[model samples]
Target: MEMIYRPLLPATQYCPCNWQSDSTSLHSLPQSKHASSFLRTLIAPYAPLWVNSTPATTDNSSDDLECPQANINYRSAFEQQKREAAKKMDATTLMMSLYVPKGRWQWTYQVPFENRPEEDPVTSNRIWSLSVRTARIYNESITYICKLYPREVQWEGFFSEVKLHKTQLRPLHGASTPALIGIQSNITGIQLAYDIPHHSFWIQASPDMPDILKRRCLDAYHQLHAQGVLHGNVDLANILIGGDGRVQIINFHKSRSTKNDPKVHLGLATPQDFNMEMREVHYKLNYLGAREKERAVWENRRNSRQTPSRRTTRRRDKDPYAIPMEPPTDPVRWLIPDNWKPKRFIVPGQSREQFEYHLRQFLLDLEKSKIHSPSEGDKSQGPNRRPPGDRSPPPTRCDLGKRKRGEVDSEDDDDDDDDDDDDDNSSSKRVRFLAQTNHDDGSKGKVRSPPPPGVKRQVPRISREYQNFGESPKTFAIPFISS
Candidate 1:
């Protein structure tokens, strides 16, 4: 056989070596600094030539020359490992970021079965199952007890039932059934998420509960029945007893509309039909021997109320307006203070000027009462003075217009009927009343001239018919002012 020479492996491959024998040597190496450091750590356990104290020879001289070349090989392998690790870390981070974030109104989660409580009744149920998960929403941490269905058809049916409950029954008041938030499905099964109520089931019999609780439960059943929902599963587990002693019926998956037959039956009847059975049970528990007598009496009374005699019908027809009438008085009149007098009404034949004078006097009296004190003498005596007697002539047409415009600056001796300059406050009040009454006249009441600055123009108080009553040929009776 021909002798063949096999090139020996480099020492750096089998044993650790200071690839950077000198600072200049390391800088001159083609491999990167990171690759060099990685290769050092990977071969840390291998004994170096310096540690072994091996003698230098011709065979070892070849190993020294090959060290840089071996380092390049090691560096490539190290870089490949780092690249794979970084790719795996980036993939894991991206998966974690894809999870659904929390929300305001509602939230959901895919929880594992291992998360459920070991002793929960849901874990023991055979026909139906549930998985528990926590959801933070609406500023509350709600523990969602999601119902799990095995088959696709079963999940579809449950979803339909919940949708019906949400749309048809949720809008009705006192329908205290737990609301469905959303549905989730996966390889394991389908889950129906509902807002979990923090309450235990109302397990006690109707007779065992207090009269109030019994009535409330009965009322809830009635309401559910009236809404056409038949709580097909009304067992102790389905009835929830709230912390505040409220009773809520839940688990509508087995429930049915009055118009449809239930998919599953647990011997529970529709609310309307169930009421009669409940009544009998209640009578048997509490009224014992008086059931028949009480039923007979109730039937007799109901029949009597339902059937009206011919004579009674005739009487009702003869007096169709027999409803009781309330007295004509202001409902809020009693809320007024006792010291406040009723508003003064105009006398039957009172003239417009007389009514105005009386109104001014009333307002002045109110002002005096507000400022009056035992120590203060009457300050009613001033430049704006009213005549002591009613003998003073009524206001003329020109004086009324001048007063309305706030042009009466001084006491006019020429016109005895003119009011004092201080009467401007009273004139403004009269103008407000006129504006209110004349509002229906539209453009007819619009002011042609603007009043002077700081002066409010008087609005006509009388209606269109009364605007030119003095010029009309016919005499019209003044409208009555009722108390």
Candidate 2:
């Protein structure tokens, strides 16, 4: 029997057939005939056909074997083409539905585009074709982010940013900031790719962040400022904090570069001509001012020993300057002490700079006062006068020890006796020294004393000369009546 094999059907269309044949000994039949029958049974649905004919070995080997090989090659090529076509269709469908580029970044379409309700009608109506979209991506491991943006928005600002990030800001790769990866512009739309950060900007205000991380955020801003870039939108939402405690400044589409045109405003309320450094200083000063206000409030509460009401606490929760109640454990805490009171100067119609200058002066004066002023109890005393009861001991007489030794000559003894007699008299008199006063009336250079009972008192005249007599000076008054 001669066997005739039909062309194989496509893999998708092929099916198996159930055929039960009785077990028969085929050893009596020819080898070729037995092989053909077994093959036909094996492929019953699309089996080879057997015909009674004389078998020609040479022609069969050349024509039949070559034809089957050629057919196999053709079938493989057709299937490969079909597979390639299906893959392309899938990619096209994904692009159309999700509006994202293919390869490496598979869009999960989980996060929706956010639009502020407070936006103006013109701004609201202006379709934001280039929106952030979330995607699941794996470089070494899987990551999720909403950092995708469309490239073909036909906006000059977008194109400028694309060029800037690609050329100048290339060194910022793998940082907390978004780095440009790829751009695809086709009939559908433009797609600008970026490396997604691990954390979003919304988590910056979380109380769980350590002081070190907050400082890192400040450092990131400084770094950007050093690069002559001003982050026009410097809200908390634009400052991203990564899982590794890394900080990044993003949303640079509205950023202004001092290296470029300094006059460009870039949607910020700051002066158009201000450089990046100036803008950075302004931000720092504003932050310091807000911190001072918070410090003042905390100080007042602490001094008053009052706990914030629930309503006040809730109100403060919405305050942009509000910080964690636990004091910061960093060097910056020293600069913004909880006891610090903001003595900002206010002039009714003064310019901002003038007001700030006055505030600076107040701070300087406060520091000076801390250094030079006396304690609270001693402040009432005049500058020259020592505190009461802090008098120095009376001057010791040099001859006092010699007088007590009893070794003096007669003349010395007489003088010593006279001095002893004067000292004794003065001790018994109970004299008190009072401050000299200037009188506005005609009676000047006169010491007044309280009159004793049944005695008229007179003002004593000032005397410049001292007499050798054992008598008290005219300025001194004796209460006892002398006989």
Candidate 3:
């Protein structure tokens, strides 16, 4: 309950408009164990001083095999690695169809998701360092990870609009997944980057791979709700294992089609890139506000892509329990702390409208030796803007860092940010989340929103920014079903 994270400095100067200004080119995705000089920089740029946990890696035996004795488990060694990924992608697309080699697919050692370089877990001291992405798969890839899943569930019943019941026939219901008619891009079509691999998991390659790996995320969430369409970006990195029993659910971008009945893939273009990753997990758990906006927008978009996320750090990256400032009350992903503080502004060539808020208040006082060390009754509940020394960092490992805030009534809706809803629909009665939704005396129900649950409400300005890039960034939807 002390949130305010903003740590990312890959050699400073600032970098996120997209990152990747050709740093010796970029390469490390073809099977990626993780080294090419640690991907070139920020493997885990001190994972934002812990921010409430997620930097503990001692994990080795997900079956353990480094290279031979093929017992298998990365979901059946990924279903014989997806039938040998179509025979090694048909002999490497027939040896790149005999082409010479022009950026081959743009692999010039492209560093910057914080410098990179962190894939060493075979011998002993084990080092992962965090910083993931590359999970593409239909063609061959798998490593995508953005972080900030501090919690999930209840973005209005996980993609709400009142049980989603759009009918006209509901796009004729699941025509085979794909929608995005009409394209317009101020850029950002996957290039926010990562060419694809949004998700893929069917694994069968063997030794029971984590019980058939979550049975392919509950059989792709019951096969996208039996194809009426509403997978609305399921979770655990959109679920993936793809090798044989192919239990998959790769990103339809945001997938909807509950019943307008055009047969399913209405037209297809991107629907705003599948509603920005199914509404960016409903604004980082909006109902809980994306569990602290995925921990302050991935620590401010990966610390503004510490030089385009080139990421780096030797050992001491610390995850003592990451406590940045927000997320930890646990009533299902806590988020009403109310301490905000830094909201000054003025970035135009940095004449310094307070010099980036005193360099973010001297990195929030050098992040008090880095917190997230919480536990002993959460350090007698003492740490606030987190500084006074070791108060958290001891959770993330296996359960994968602080997760439980899931099962709510209904709370997942998207489109996200750039919003500004005033709301007053004449006594209101809108529930249009289309998938099957039909309550209010109709059928599928659940509707109530009053800051009740154990009571603790305050967080109102969920978002607001005006650095003036020509001005325009307000976003506020908040509509997932109520009356």
Whose TM-score is greatest here? 1
Candidates, ranked, lDDT: 1, 2, 3
Compared to the true structure, candidate 3 yields what TM-score? 0.18
How well is each residue in 368-396 modelled by candidate 2, as lDDT tens digits? 54455444344333234454565544435
lDDT (tens digit, per residue) of candidate 3 on 259-359: 53233333232334333433333332232233554555456544554212323352233322222222212233322223211111111122222232333
Determine which window of 10 residues in candidate 1 has minimal summed lDDT. Answer: 320-329
Sorted on TM-score, best first, the list reads 1, 2, 3
**Clashing pairs in model 1?**
434-461
Off by over 4 Å in 2: 1-156, 186-188, 199-202, 205-210, 261-483
For residue 271, what is the lDDT in candidate 3?
36
The residue pairs found clashing in candidate 2 are none
Residues 313-430, candidate 1, lDDT per residue (tens digit)?
3221232111111111222221223332111111122233333333333334434534542212322232233434544567889988986766554454445433543354556544
By TM-score, is 1 or 2 better?
1
- Candidate 3: Cα lDDT at 483: 25
lDDT of each: 0.42, 0.39, 0.31
